[model samples]
Target: MVTPCPSLGPPAPYVRRNVTHPASLSAWARLLGRYARCIRGRRRDENRKRGSGMEIHWSHVEEISEDERHAIEARLSALAAGHTDMIDLRIVGRGTGHHRHGGKEIRVACQVRGREIVAVRSADDLGLALDQAIDAFEREVRKLREIRSTHRDERPQNPPYLGIVDRVLHAAGYGFIVTDGGEKVYFHRNAVHGGLEFERLTEGDRVALNIEAGEKGLQATTVVPAPPGVPAP
Candidate 1:
């Protein structure tokens, strides 16, 4: 019997493999475009989440002109530049009289790490109100900066406190000292002149301590035995 060569069975019936698909380029391009879009969207979301370093929001100022808004923003930015710790400002302006007759009142608030600062002002006109409020806010910001700078400068210049060790917890590695002013200040073993010396401390031992503000209250930055013959103050 004569058999066919069997090289192929009816040309494989055009099963349409991926390599033979006409839409492959377009499909790949669509996928790449979608990926790009996804990447761009993620970046945009990240940028929004991070936000600009400092921000200002407004309320009830829509009645004011654009130029006025720009002026107010610029003034506030100038005020904030001096205080690096200041972030997030909000400005609000309200009309006191019906039909915008009497005057405008403005309030400005800013945020710091641990506190909020605010200023308020009023005037017969929107421009004047904004100007006065921003000026007051600037002064407040300046005063805050000066006060903090002064506090930091005073810390090292101030003399160490004179005290007597009123209590000691050898097991806990901590102690307390009574200042000459009768205030009890806390001290940890780390604050001692040497950890080994802290072990020798007794309830009545005299100590000289450098006082500082702590989360729980007054504490000693340095704790050392008082010099011989020095009276506890």
Candidate 2:
């Protein structure tokens, strides 16, 4: 005769006690939904703060108050306005040996188009030092923008023309070129192009160039070696 095991005889039915009503369940769901929305909103605000691309660092000093930090951030954002080339900015604050007397130093570094511009200032008060540093930083940024604008305005707009190096100031980093049409155009070391070394350039070297009217006078925006067998004009 075969015997049956006690564990396999029969399964017991499961019962849940104190079951929640449908209305209570709905209320809990709404509460949870509101909590989730609140969390998402906070995350968005934090993300916006990070997206500003500004950072502050403290060295041998305690962190500043939230009000001060906010003020600094606002100032930086205002300074960066309309400047799309700026990548990021960093501010560093340090306490001097006379920390008890409130001596502080502030440094601001700005990165723009792969270039770093920095400014440093020290004062009896941290706020004054920061203000001075920011003022210097703004001036540097404005100067850089002006220089870029000048370079853009100096870009050539016409085709290359044949010319001869009429004069070169080896110590001055500049020279003059006489074009085929007998027009003399000035060229700086920065204008040398086509892999040509400005240091190796000498008087009477045949070159091809594009000229434009500059703030001073006619200038060669680009300069390269002249092609072979090109008849001099």
Candidate 3:
């Protein structure tokens, strides 16, 4: 025979039962359905926000064909390849004037880096107008890129002042380098490197010059051909 163990403080209190009225149950079911729907809607909105990374706005002249729109999108994507920021494209089409022969106008504005680059064109034919506008837009984008590249903050390994060969006195073996900054520095034929000769240099020739203070003043100690591809000052 086995002895029964003593109860631990009688039996613990019974578990609480979840009791609800019919009306309450219905209200809870409805509340749960609404919550689920809200969750689904929020998810959809998030997905859409992710998918539409670029914001493109289109307006009247109704002249842009589907194919042309696609082409424009492709071009813009190429322009925005390296940029992770949002790109906004606003395109407008309208008549240049109210006159009978007034040409159509297509205007495109690209928002980049907190600046707006706008291109506009008017043509007798709608397609021609669109083409011209796109060309102009591309040119604007290219110009912006060039400006940014030139003004970028990165330091180069061997930075040199950009200048032009203003004057050359072959006999004296000395010449002046007129920097884009409008300052002039003196250089001698011996200072030119890379097989460059004072005799071969002409006025308005682009060059990169390294300057230092000499007994006379700031002098170009070294000069070369704008480092091959760099622009003159």
Candidate 4:
């Protein structure tokens, strides 16, 4: 029989212990939850800052407070909400010669489609100047929209044409007139000229109107009853 190998030392006793401390486990979980919440909060803040597409530039101006900046952004966003064609908006603030004497100037520029619209204002305070500039910009945008809706650029300035009322839709507040050339034109009650009531119109009634290529088709504008004694063409 082979001799057994001698043991190097006495056998060590085995011990069992808890893999993790209960307090530490709970603390670790709480720490992870706090970290997750912090991350979400930061993301929300970032989204709020990026919500608007307008850009602001400051020149020779003092740093503004967060409240003031937020207020300005809210106003700009409100102004741009209804206009889908507005591609870009920029607001520039400048401090003139001196804070007390020269005051501040604000300029708001909007790029719509291929055109640019701008408004500028100067006031003793930056807030006042910005408000005035935004107001002016809003008016410009309204004017531009009205012009486009009427297609004023494409309308002809020729003399009015004579036509006869072909049909009237009393309930709908609109009517159609047949021109002397046999072209049919649409007219809304609002188009009646000289404050004439649309209800007064009847089939076969003579009317003079300026025509334009409207969104739907040929439409009459500034419609009025033909002058007495004018022979129908």
Candidate 5:
């Protein structure tokens, strides 16, 4: 019996196997174009801000005067010249007002470009981009405030707490605190602030402790054993 050579499969079907997948070079170019525009705008805004920051605007907060208008134009021009293509830049808000007829609130958008920022915009005109930028800036400011207020420690920090000695061997001079969270914090006899050695500690004994960082982990220091009837503090 004779078999077909099997080498005669259609060329079109075989060639189609290597066909290139669909891709959108033009779409990518358009998307990048839009992004580029946003970046350029940000840079221009930055330059305007730098220039405006150097010169004072109108003394009155209520309005923008002729001098301020010229200043704003010059700053914008400077930005156009220096920063034709740039990306996300810093903006420091400078002023705020309402649109005519109190239609909407406006916040000044200032950013740095080149040697200085020359960009300026009313927040109302900046759209969602400006809103996000302001929110991010405010978030950073809040975090900084928190960092400044709290005590930063090179070592780990934990909350001070009150506990009760669940068990202690007077001879061993060591005990464990049953924390309010039901966690046990190991303590040595020397941890007692009163310098009085416990005769014998047992379960349900109340105590006060200042949580401390230890070699292993969090431990209790300045322990004060409480009498049977009183709660640990």
Candidate 6:
């Protein structure tokens, strides 16, 4: 059996803090610091008053250092003429534009929290965008590096070329070679280096572009069989 004693004077107000680790304590300190300094008018509402999403407009990608500015311009051009419409651009650290540099009529997208521009992967690709609002150029280079590494690993020393048949619709006995992507390729009557023969070409043989793109989606410049064990070039 237990006896009921007098109640403690007003239950001590609940203290909600539950610090467990030093890192937690440090984090709490930093949060408290932010709360303390971010009082009153400007600091209090600065982050909250953004219109929708933040957008950084970088019009003067040029006018910077010759190399850096050119790099940014290259990225813009690639985006403008790339196949992928997506560019993971980020606005890591922004710099105030110069007198004749920025603050002009610029186009902006949703600005990212942190990132920068670098270089282009394949200048031959089509359908990217310019007027990029990028920050750093080096980071983009890292992306390029990763792509190259993957390409080197997956791609063969020599891949087959792709092209469209550029000859009469000869159903009987005629010859045609596919023009590789963006370039021109030669398809001799005996050029079908594959197990098949050139004479067996169909109208639209879907293939991978193993060549460079020339004026107006020109066919392959160097047409060849896709499989290995063909005669040397």
Q: For all candidates, what are the clash counts?
A: 1, 0, 1, 0, 18, 21
Instruction: List per-candidate RMSD values in Å.
Output: 15.7, 17.1, 21.0, 16.5, 21.8, 19.9
As a TM-score, model 3 comes out at 0.41
- In model 3, which runs have C-alpha deviations exceeding 4 angstroms? 1-52, 98-102, 154-233
Q: If scored against the real structure, what TM-score would every candidate get?
A: 0.42, 0.41, 0.41, 0.39, 0.28, 0.23
Residue pairs with colliding backbones in model 2 are none
Residue-level lDDT tens digits of model 4 in 1-233: 99999888987888888699899999999999899567545543443355432334444434445466566656666655544345346778887766664478887886543357889888888778877888898888888878887896686553369889999998776799999999999876656765566888899998888777754588775688776788888
Q: Local distance difference test, per candidate? A: 0.70, 0.72, 0.71, 0.71, 0.49, 0.38
Compared with the true structure, what per-residue lDDT tens digits does model 1 show for residues 1-233? 99868666456565755564668888988999899567545543443244323556778986778567766665665555534345457889897774444378888887543346788877788778788888888887778777877887657543467888889999766788899899999877656773338778888877777776654677786777665687654
Who wins the lDDT comparison?
Answer: 2
CA lDDT for candidate 6: 0.38
Please provide, for model 2 over 102-215, each residue's C-alpha lDDT reduced to its tens digit, 9 standing for 90 to 100: 578888876554457899888887778878888898888889888989897576553469989999997766799999999999887656777688899988898998776654
**Model 3, total clashes:** 1
Tens-place lDDT per residue, model 6, 112-167, is: 11122333221111111222334223345445556756876777655555445556
What candidate 5 gets wrong by more than 4 Å, as runs, is 1-160, 226-233
- Over 59-97, each residue of candidate 3 has an lDDT whose tens digit, in order, gives 895667767766776666666554522245788888777
Ten consecutive residues with minimal summed lDDT in candidate 5? 108-117
